[model samples]
Target: MAGDTKEGVTLELVTGSAEIFGTDLQLNKKYTFPSGTRTAVFTYQGCTLELIGPTVHAYVSNNTPMAIFANTHAGLEDICRDTENGEASRGFVVLVVGPTDVGKSTLCRILCNYAVRKGRSPIFVDLDVGQNCLTVPGSISAAIVDQLADPVHGFQLEQQISYCFGSTTPTANMPLYELLIRKMAENTAEWMKRSRNACISGMIINTCGYITGEGYKTLLTIAESFEADLVICLEHERLYMDLNRDLPNFVKTLRFPKSSGIEDRSQNVRSYGREAMVQRYFYGTRALPLKPYRIEVPFESVEICQLGAEKLPDSCLPFGVSADDHHTKVVYMKPDMKLQHHLMAVSTAKLISPEVLNHNVFGYVVILEVDLQNHTFALLSPVNELPSKVLIYTEVVFMDDQINL
Candidate 1:
């Protein structure tokens, strides 16, 4: 029940119990869809239902926002042309900014889709760790768009170049979040350098919806990192004004209204949306069923590392151990039973240095139980084998739908 999307799906909870993340669905009544976030409907019992999907359809109705965006894209095409002739170092880097549910992701998808239709292979960069675009929530990911996006699954292609924070909000660990973004930008620059197609095709950088204070500052930081050519703001003229007033004069800004059809989600709803995605990941989409296997491994086979944490008060710390170094250091911990049911990302690198550990995740595993009784570790993962020996513990936590003591 957790994987329903807003694009299209209709079902009647027929005979059994089901819940969307933590919200229970009403039985014998019809449910239409998710507002925007990915959802997991856990049918605690063997559930039955009448389901139909992709039920929504529409014509090529060009709204003002899409039209303006597409026109800007046409200008970017000219930038792409310039890049081809060696007149420019890069093509247009479009950065979209807006408050919650103002149709930022939708605009990104539309722009990318339109570009692909025109035969341009732009790289789509998703910085919104709260929404599932190129990859799961809690991660910033990117991918090259060679084909049009599927209405249902989205641009879920290319294994999605990604980096994770394990939490929904960035300000909790702003410095770490900033570092990861810098790393992603650096890697993306390297990717564009090697791929001519991507260079000309440019990129559409989608960002998180936190648009005030540190969030606003973070958006500006990303714009500077990408050297964004144009900044698009939806539903807020003040945001547009602020960006224009502060950013380099060369960076163009767009102020657009909130789309009439956009869905507004509150903080609690946003939290649930991320929860839904984390669940859908290990549990599989309703279109596909993934029976994740649980296995036991020796305690020494892997290491669990956690990213940024708030500093312990100097009063609470041992003498001379100041809080200054607490922010940048990663904790390399010995695995234990306390890690049970915590979701951990498995990475490909051996990762001896914490400085080199802000890397993409290969996959995820949930600690089912840590058997101190036998000095072993138990984990639940979708794939059959471990991708690597390094495990990064994220703030992301998902409770197993199935009851486990």
Candidate 2:
């Protein structure tokens, strides 16, 4: 797994009693051999590994060969292209934002992985006040403050920014993304000073999905602060585009919602098929002919009631809910249940965008049989803000249980 600098020459050490050399034997050179080497071999390295030995013994070790692109300076050039206009010390700043289950943290993990793989320490910062997946679950500020208080800790802090709210003190009403620009700059500067690693030159900030007018404002503020090089809007970007009438196929490729129950329908009951219809009704694109399951009731009783409806259509029960308003407005799940469930808010929140339904911390949707004894419902999203009350009716179906009409 190591690389060599000399073109067309490969160097490798053998663990067994064999010594091999690519160069000619020199009297002045020390012919160091493995302690237990009873044989010697030679090999050539190029696009592939070739083993040449005196005795024929071939075993590939079952190590799967990974396709790795050769390292090129083009990547550095691409990274620098965004920062060329900025100060020499300050590199490009990239921001990553998404909904609760859209894999914001996962994206951060990928970025960190890429950075570490490149022998760099990417200054990471988590601004998800809801889930704080990178930080402590509930204690967002504490987790971040503790890290800053002790930077030399044995724990390998994910080269991240504050994982909690930026404000040091909690207030009844504070500005969204408060202290973000200042904190990001301060912490990044601190890390740069402490660790003189050139790779620690860039910054990445992860944001919460619960972007209120205030939250969105905060995001724009931070972007302005850094004059960011790139803004990677994650999950919500698609929904936003669709609402704004500029949907991209890259976004439409996401899974739609589905029905939550149908495995126990009566012989004449075609609930799953009907749920599929509802999914098609809303999405009207490439919906599958199946329903997604009702995973969980992520919303609190108050939240559910506030949704303004408790019953869905007779056909799309437990998965689709229509507004009582005269608009015949309907909300339904995406066709791919598993993918939607994996990446979206469960149950009712499936219809809502992640930006409006940040439930990773305070609450989230869960799916399970309604009356099944001792069955557990899993959390689907993080609760970041209180939901607005809209006139809506919703219903979910379980094997033997039912929601009242």
Candidate 3:
């Protein structure tokens, strides 16, 4: 099929030649793909491919929820006209939520694109620390949609507000995930207040796909954290029903069908997707690859810290050691070979809290080699100098010899 995807997702190039957003894709390569809003793929000779997620048009046609969602945005836009002190005051906040593969993230993008299509600005809040569209995976991030994203280019990462979650799934550290969400909300709210247009332009928050038990409770917590006025639930009838029953009466709930094109991904496919996203983060698109300049940083110059250490019981500890060890918190790491080829984020947080450290990722670093003799670490980074010495190790580690270009 030589058609553009209504949903932006991992599109695998099978055996044939295909051009995604005008850039020809390589055989057997998976892509974080996008095609224009209504653009369709047309093959000249032959092509084979698989789109692994829901399409916006397919989902919209299921019940025309896009029109309904657009209507809601129209109402919010009307409020933007209501100004106080010559500044736009209040606007609607829509939070999209559901389990994985139900088209939640795609919906958020579509809504933002639609708003931008109408010449309106919408802030996209990505709380899906795992599969965030704006930043890398395992991050809570936000970006303002001041202009329409390229159907081929995807969301612009220039002016992004992000916090690194370090791991893919929130289940690994539930409290840390919750803390990141609250921190994301607080920061986003502060940004909204700064700009009259950003405040009145409204925002759409995309949440992680964890909607049962703690995941279900986490939904309410996320909604409350963002002060969401509307919750868009896709596919899962139980989730829609549950949110309606449990959410406050003031909060509006909307349920829509999941696109027929969406597929449930396996673990291997997910791992490949994460690798693809990280690779794309540093290196631009395959058609126009970026040359990431690498330089070595002395081990003594930067501080490396690892998050979520398993706590050892006091009985097993040595006497007179800092009696109250924050085992669950982030602790500094001594130089080791295991740190080789591992990814680290430069911390931006001035005040380090166990929970707040998640938000401080300013830039990424990949340990290239460990020099025991020289006691220096060679690392690859997009930038030359480190933004801050407070570095925290992240979950996704890349191979030293991996082809980023």
Candidate 4:
């Protein structure tokens, strides 16, 4: 039988026939053997036959790394009945990566809750240091992690995840991300031994903030170290890794982005190495602008501003200038009646120039939009240029209810 190498399942031919006292043999491995079984037990590949009747001859052959097993007439029902041994071999390890406050901790909690509901326990590690968001003193209890295991239900292994916080350094490039991942894996492996009947089934490593350059490399290294089964990237679009491209190490990936809230916005900016004032600049720069334009979207509107690589027209843009150009600042003004708040959109294209575009002196722009309803703002894009339609919509005014000519 053939199985995934990562699954750690091996095919061993034991000293038994296809049927022993009416019990049939089965293999849930990925590949199947072609040869049929006979009355006498035979061995194939590295599998050995240890006969229990009289003379037990153990066969040990060195076969191919993943060769086809061409021996076995196990019944179809028996073959089908062999369930996937997800719990047998090395358990699954999942790594969650994304910008801060994007529900990484919340999702971890949910997963733990899910494991608990299924009578299984899960460990949680809070590595985010800037905000002790995960390790809020009384948030986690050791008693809960210890109780789920029992003699009757068998030891469903669950460990209280370890935290490696405060070691992350802004100067060291990628502060301890690799170290933290390695430590968690090693520690979980150690904990697995204590369980009476069960072993560590899986591990979840939650990452912090927008990882780039060294940090990104460090994250990849961590995933590889743990032989990660799944890599969950939250709000990955903002990370700019061209996630559409296939990654090497991780078997599967999941992307989930939470809506931007005030707390989320604050955390996102802080994670980008920006000071509070710079964050304020990107968010509340224009407390009062000289002249601002307006655009209106009714409650029916859902998707706003789907952008592309089109240069905006000068006339349709705010401040009578192209939003993509360094000299322009697109500020939107809305009356506090229907929407009950004012919205301001600003571009830091001129102030920082190439710095805003990470020193890529090309036609890059930093477009920031702020919704005043809940004091939430977003640094939307740092791309080639502004979209033509978006520029037009920015300058147009909403009269009565609809945008007017």
Candidate 5:
């Protein structure tokens, strides 16, 4: 069963057993799904649910790709068992790829949940910057999936490492996107060495839906960087064939049809989701609200760096060289009124340089107010103090209700 709740909805398992994103629902207990939530309930055995409240649409269908999902999980489990038995030297890594709205994220969630339920801990790497499950939009993040994800809240944020590409799409800066993916892969490798369970259980990667031109190249980069053992392509036969032809023989590729319940969202709906995600970062959720601190910092105290090369006219370029020569240029900027309402990443780097692009961020802050006269800016941050002296500027902007700084 799948539905879109409008003004929130309540679900009760009337008979049999069922699960949402791999978490079992309690019998006779009510589960409240928040408004604007798109979800589906799955069960191997036939079950009945009583739903209450308004919804955009609701439906029940026996046709689902859940059996394929379960079989894939079983195959991964066998690989893990092989590693544990000393038949393999390292854990297996699975990469899920496909176009947008193809249920790639859903498959990833189901796989992670199944792994956790079987006493395994798999690392979840989210490369989809447009709608990341592990962190806010415009970033690539990874987290250890040690428990089943909540149906409403999704994955729990713990020990998550993220790098802000400063844009929702990789098309903004392909070099920066690829750079972050490499850094994430290196970090994940080191993390796996520390935990035997994590190493044996392996990692599951979720990528963006962009599957043409530069997007295709980005997928290859991710596969090679992470040394992915298996590539699962959903609903895109062309992509599957291209990857099989281009990728090395050591890597196996499989294609699966997309779920019938998948729905394509419009640009406006996607933008709304991104804005809501940013708000949730600082404000928490309805169930657990958080108080974000607003602090005024001197402009001279920290350095702000922006990624991307400076655009120059073709006439100024030498010979056949193009403007895309310097894709990783780090330009420093002074605070001004234009910075207001934009999000800035608090870099782990102590100084502004090109190396900052390779480092993971401490967190993010919104520029609430920029005072040119006082040479100080007001920031709305989740923490009281900025952890680093360097900040990276991003193209993502957020505007909340007006507040006195």
Candidate 6:
């Protein structure tokens, strides 16, 4: 069965056993699914459910790729077990790639959850900036999957490390996106060196839905950066063949069919989801309320920079240098009204320019109001105090109705 929750849903297994995203549900216990959740419940045998609250739509289908998914999970388990037994030299990494609404994220979740259930902790790296599950949109994040994800809230955020890329689509800034991915891979490698269980259990990476042209190239880049041992391509034969031909001989590539339950989401729905993620970051949910602090800080106290390539005429450029040569250049910005309603990342870098471009962000703050005359900015942040003075400007603009209050 599959459905999209509108307001919320309380699901109880009426008969037999069932699982969602590879995590088995308790026989008689109730599970709450929050709004905007798209999920599918699967069972080996027959099962019944009692669903409370209204949903956008719900239905049961006889056709599903659950068997193939289970087999794939079993293969990954074998690799993990072999590594643990010293039969393998290093941890195994699996990269999931496909077009939009092809069940890549779902597959990654199922594999991670299955690994955790088998007493293993795998690193879950989410490179989907368009719809990141671990953090807000326009950011790439990674976290160790030591526990099953909540059906409603998804993954926990305690140990997650995220880097803000500022735009939902990598097409807006491909170089920056690639840079962030490489940096994330480096960090994950460092993390693996510390945790033996995590190293042996390996990583499951989820990528964006862009699977053609430059998107295809980005996949190869990711595979090389992470040194993926296996690549799972969902519902895209050309992509599968391309990866198999291009990737190293040691890497294994497999294609899987998309789930019939997976539905294509409209652009408006995607926009709403992105907005909701931003709101949840600062405001929290109804069950767990958060108090965001609104503080006014002098403009001079912080440094604001925007990431972009220098736009100079070819005549003024060096002989061999092109305009796109400096794709990750940091340009300073003067405080102005234009900054209002936009999200700014508090970067960990102490210095400006090169340092800021290389470092990840500490957190984000929304510019509630920009007071140019007073040289100050009214900001709404989850933390009481800003973590850093270096701020990176992003294209994401959040227009909260509660900002006036």
> Taking the candidates one at a time, how many backbone clashes does each contain?
6, 42, 3, 1, 0, 0
Comparing 1 and 2 by lDDT, which wins?
1
lDDT of each: 0.73, 0.34, 0.70, 0.34, 0.87, 0.85
Give the worst 10-residue stretch by lDDT in candidate 3: 57-66
lDDT of each residue in 1-405, candidate 4, tens digit only: 212122222233353333211112333322121121112222232233323222222232242211111111121112212312432444445566786556564454444433443444334444443432222111111112333222111122223342221123421223333443455556555554555222443444555564776667666666676566667677667453543254573367666555332133443434332222222222222221121223333322211221112445666667755454422222232322322211112222233222221111111112233455744322222222232112111211112121121
**Each candidate: RMSD:** 8.8, 19.6, 7.3, 23.2, 2.3, 2.2
lDDT top scorer: 5
- Write model 3 residue lDDT over 1-405, tens digit each, in one string: 222445555666687775432235667776664433223333446677666665444321233344455576666666555643345446678988888987787677767766665666778998876676786777778888886654455676566777766788888777777877888888878878897667777788988888999989888988898888889898789989999999999899988776555667678656756666667677767545666757767777877777667767778778885534443477778888988877777778543456436455786777778898898888777777777777777778777456443
**Least lDDT summed over 10 consecutive residues: which range in candidate 2?**
145-154
Kindly report which residue pairs in candidate 5 clash with one another: none
Stretches of candidate 5 off by over 4 Å are 1-6, 313-325, 402-405
What digit string (tens of lDDT, one per residue) describes model 1 on residues 1-405? 222345556667788885432234578876655444333344545577676665333222224354465577688878888888999888789999988778788778877876776778888898887775665666777888887764434554653577767666776677777888888899888878889988888999998788999998998999999889889998877888889888999988888886554446677777776776667666655545457777778888887777765688788878877676566667787777678877787876676357535677787788878888787887888776888778877666667776232
Deviation (Å) of 316 in candidate 1: 7.7
For 161-225, candidate 2 gives per-residue lDDT tens digits of 33223121212123323443444555555664565443234655666665555656666665555
TM-score of each: 0.79, 0.34, 0.78, 0.37, 0.94, 0.93
Clashing pairs in 1: 1-40, 1-41, 2-39, 2-40, 2-41, 3-39
Rank by lDDT, highest first: 5, 6, 1, 3, 4, 2
Q: How accurate is candidate 1 locally (lDDT)?
A: 0.73
Off by over 4 Å in 1: 1-64, 85-87, 283-293, 314-324, 402-405
